[model samples]
Target: MIRWALIFLVVALIAAVLGFGGIAGAAASIAKILFYIFVISLLISVVMILINKSKR
Candidate 1:
């Protein structure tokens, strides 16, 4: 998931550099969304681990 976010980020940069405004915007937005999703999931996993440790 993090990998995908990075991929889209790079694609966005390349598209913007190449003067493809629409594609660049879309890719940037998608990268932002993916990054948020990845962060949220990682946080949830950490919380779950903490909860499990506490239960032990």
Candidate 2:
């Protein structure tokens, strides 16, 4: 998931450099959304692991 975000970010950068404003904007937004989702999932997983460890 994080890798995909990075891919989109790179795509956005390339598109922008090529003067594709619409494509760049769309890719950037997708990347941003993916990044946030990845972060939230990571945090949730960490919290879950900590909780389980503490229970043991």
Query: Which candidate comes out best when scored by lDDT?
Result: 2
Pairs that collide, model 2: none
**Candidate 2 residue spans exceeding 4 A from truth:** none
Question: What is the C-alpha lDDT profile of model 1 across 1-56, one tens digit per residue?
Answer: 89999999999999999999999999999999999999999999999999999999
Q: What TM-scores do the predictions have? A: 0.96, 0.96
RMSD of each: 0.5, 0.5
- lDDT of every predicted structure (CA atoms): 0.98, 0.99
Colliding residue pairs in candidate 1: none
Error of 2 at 11 (Å): 0.5
The digit string of per-residue lDDT tens for model 2 on 1-56 reads 99999999999999999999999999999999999999999999999999999999
Model 2, position 41, has a per-residue lDDT of: 100
